[model samples]
Target: MLSLDYSKLLILAVVIAIVLFWPPKNKSFHRRGIDPGFLNLKVWPARIWFLLRGRNIVEQAYLQEKDAPYLLQSLNEDSLVLPPKYLPELRMLPGGKLSASEALVTSVLGQHSGVDVVLKDRQHYDIARVQLMRSLPTLVPILSAKVDSILSETLAACSTADFTHVKIKEIVSALVLRTTLLTFVGPELCENTELQWLVEEFTNIVRDMAIFLLFIPKFLRPVLWPVLPPTARMKRLHERVRRILFPKTEKNVKSSRDFPTVIDHFVATSEIVDEKEIVAKFLVLMAGALHTTKMSTSHAIIDLCASPECVDELRNEALAENLNDLPWHLDQVSCLKKLDSFLKESQRFNPPNYLSFDRIATSTFTLQDGTAIPKGTFISMAAGPMAMDPGYYEDAQTFSATRFCKTDESAVESGAEKSQWAHEFVSTESGNIHWGHGRFTCPGRWYASAVMKVVIAQILRKYEVKFPEGQRERLPNVYLDLIVEPNPKQVVRFRARE
Candidate 1:
């Protein structure tokens, strides 16, 4: 008997989330070695080891030892990882000459053979981001409509009430999927289930393949990359994408098409590259925006459900600002200051991976404290440590939604220097806590911020979420083989509020 009850599923999910998050018993899993070869082979084992030890890789090794503001270490460029303090020096060759961003991407995808953006430096990332971000302020209505449709469709198949819980993941997944499809394939194709399913599957295949592919020998990688099943699916997704792309092949592509999506801009301005190359960009665009954005937002929703104080403030802000009935304007997105505060607090407490940015020296460079890092080196900030470090943020590991708020309040009270806390929150120009300081940071940051705001607002306005009775806040343990990612999955419930 296939007894399917979503509430039960949510209960099981909460259990799973707890298990995934429960600190492991090993501490060395979080420690670093200088070789990518060592990481690729033993990432899982290391994660398990570190989980048992209760120390992240960095915490177990360098971070614990360094009492000075910063210190010199013998770790070299190709080390699979580097300690936190050396990150800035590792960002560029001395004098801001050569960047280390290239090394990070190359390490992830295994080959720069295809991503032209990698070869072009920050220019390509910036242009693509500008095009995408410039289009967001206009997408408010389109995104709202898509969200409603996803909710209606998702709830249509569900049954939840006061005594029941709903596996919020499916509902949220539906929301993310529909919104992404609208942007990627345009509304006409987006509403098509067949196409949307294909796109979602294609995304899943690429990510899973990436995880598995990293284990293959470097020599075998180049030879095997093309033979992977995900590569074949990518070709098909691309072929379909090209069919959708050709109409705007610059003949009459408008700067702002009715939808103004990545596909609209790509075929409109740039010379046509290889079909695979174009597909790769589109795939990356979808994956980049949806995966991280959805995961973070979903977790936030769960956190809010767990903390009614946070949710009540968010709901009041959204309703007070006329968010419910109005189209999602940029102002509406911005008015949720408390919501933003809550989001930042969540990130502070549970960063994607106990680390954020990646850097590798192109040449030898010295730290602010006079430590020399050899050229072509790798390093990442201790995300868990940095965000948790009281030196930078008070009560570093605690969730203080009003922590930055206090900064703003103090500025207002002084009536001298106005608080730019929110501005700093939104501004990538100043770059904080390793969101890839400066230009090489994720180009899609603005788009990401917008989506997060919309989703949070939507949830706050419509649902009352809460953790199961007696459950506690869960902070994930991230294991970075390449980059930081949230631990596997979490389960939580959402019920429509009257």
Candidate 2:
């Protein structure tokens, strides 16, 4: 085994050397537009710069290029950074022409990461877009109750007089994961600590492996995959996940439970009957919903803590709506306009990703402006930069908790012709592309928004939370490549309200 490992390492080193020294082929399509300065560097070095300062590169490119598309080279792939102006035309293209799933697979090295299920079968996406969404009215109250219960039990040690320290990310992650699992699986299995451990472990291993593999050229992944340590661990965890989920999936298919779940919907709607296939579908769903919601919720909490005035306003809004009451309806929740605006602003400042509307061209296509998107080219919008663009928003860099709510309030007071839901957190307008845009916009966004609102409302009503002493501002987000996440290590103090 030792000898085999040594030989694998030697081969890896040779591959690395070749990748570093090789001159990358310049795409003719990239020649059509201005090259982001970093793209002029050698392949490995360019990717290194991107990995280190991707956000800056993207923001600078967006500022320089403005309405035109520009080329950006990253660790794993090269993407055309399309401006928000092109969203109207690009969103209308059929999936066969511009494939989001293909882009997702490429971004994550899904084939080798054991999540090729996203590429192979889109049953999970369909369930999310249709069944899961259609069932939100029924799911919201259940999730709200679950969130309240989890927070109550988790924060039981806190008192009205003194604050108890907690890692906000961990607390929010546990809450989101358990509640998400409750909707994906059943209540009993959702609480299974062993299964929870396996799922979280599998996700972390896959994420770490994906990021590491992204640094390697695409062609070399297959060659080096077998010897990668995380790959082996992922396989073991996958097998354990299958063992735990297979029986549950089979039982779910055969019986009807009181509260139907995402698994139930999968079993009913999908032609896939194989237990392993079902497990893969479930894993994909969990991966999509769990981390994004957790991070968004955590960021909102951090943002709330940083702005005490907003907390009081949001708490007042929640109280006015009686948010603590059980069996809250969607209509009732929607009335918390101030809370919704605060969440939207929080997301605008700290989106889950710096880029959005990522797609890969299936066939060569030219835009109306004569810019050609060659086949296999990856594309994305500079969503983070767009949020801060002063053209779209006034005082864009400053965070106003009522930024979006003011529009709604004005519309009501003036009786204007604006849609009430225009600026809500889940809105996917070109200006607000965090949830994505057009037909393929996130189907589960409404669910995610409701979950966030419920969690925040509960925290606002039941507890007083703030940054630890001497920390006055929100912690800076931790950026990894294009991914942006709330600082996981940031601590907050929570005390039960009198």
Candidate 3:
């Protein structure tokens, strides 16, 4: 009976896949056209090819069609790949027309997975944009202190006269989550080990659910969600998170603290004060903040370990600035030009994702060049390829640690201020879209940058890090469809600096 039921479901799924994967009979490509490769095949085969070689496919298309818009069929949807030239116009389009949030919802199957906070309410993001940015001046010092304390404890616990192997991702993830939670909840609540475990588990659960649901047809999600193991785990985790966070959120809503947190701001500003709503918002914010920052920091450390020659250079810069002797000021952090450039270079080589400026057209629109974008068409820029394109950066294939800072050298010689010479890691320029571009560019970038700088600088000042013996290069990055991640098991040897 069970086998028979499974067979029926499998047959039903294939039928749905066949219908969904059927190519449009009258595919239109306004002025600029669909990639020739995609035009010749049924959309399913093209999507399969994409899953196999999406990065290379994107790079090839970008190199081949540098000037014009082209269409590429991806799993789940077709995206109109636009050149950077269209960025200015696209940025100006109102959210109702070109909706990044809606694009995210489609990308993640958010409606089925309960990750639609952006579409349901913009208040959390607005609070992050305004209050979070407003609080950074005060927040930086607090974060710096927290980072220093955490690193000191980490190093002490792992101390050995000789080098000791430590998983870099584990260290970085713990540090990123703790600091993120400190900023979100408060110092006291951030220290709850159970709460921390739940948040991490919850992030993993949601990510797995999203991936599982991605292959399921949209119409079938409602039917299948109840029996999905991840869904059950998600429900239990959500309840656990609410139980842990509700009392604190309820308390915060009534009275503000001296040092305002992201939760406090969300409660104080948002009209919706329901405990479940606040907890959901917190989970969304924590997941975003924890994942990207953790990956970037881990990659930066691995990059540093691989480029041993640059280690002393960065260490000297950190020591020269007395970064460890005092709480970090934003301006002081900015002045670490060499470190900043190295970080930017690392990220250029290992971005969080291959695409950026992702949006879905809510209504049909025409480009200045007469290319038409039909309503419901998904769109993205080939950000990963563009970052390495020779047209954008000279010797783009090589990792030049000082590529961004070399201009600063001339500025310094001309007596320009350090601020003038400093290149920010959070730049969303066309040439560097590691952070998504436009009005919807990452809101917490400034905070992420500050935290990363502090954590890396502390490591350089207090410890020596290198890849395990015989590992001469950084571990190759793991790629999942469009997303990129530093290898979670990558290990580095660490010893306290004498």
Best by TM-score: 2
lDDT of 1 by residue, 218-262 (tens): 678778888887677666766776666554456543433476666
Candidate 3 C-alpha lDDT tens digits along 310-393: 988888998888744788777778778888888889998998889877889999988777878889988888888878877667
Better model by TM-score: candidate 2 vs candidate 3: 2
Ordering by lDDT? 2, 3, 1
C-alpha displacement of 343 in model 3, angstroms? 1.3
Model 2 pairs whose backbones collide: none
Question: How far does residue 240 in candidate 1 sit from its true spot (Å)?
Answer: 4.2
Whole-model lDDT values for every prediction: 0.57, 0.79, 0.78
Off by over 4 Å in 3: 1-26, 29-47, 157-160, 248-258, 408-422
Name the best candidate (by lDDT). 2
Q: Candidate 2: lDDT of 185?
A: 81
RMSD of 1: 12.5
After aligning candidate 2 to the native by TM-score, how far in Å is the CA of 94 from where it should be?
Answer: 1.1
| Candidate 2 clash figure, as a count | 0
**Over 4 Å off, model 1:** 1-55, 66-101, 112-117, 120-124, 157-164, 202-204, 207-216, 224-233, 244-257, 363-370, 408-419, 423-434, 469-472, 475-489
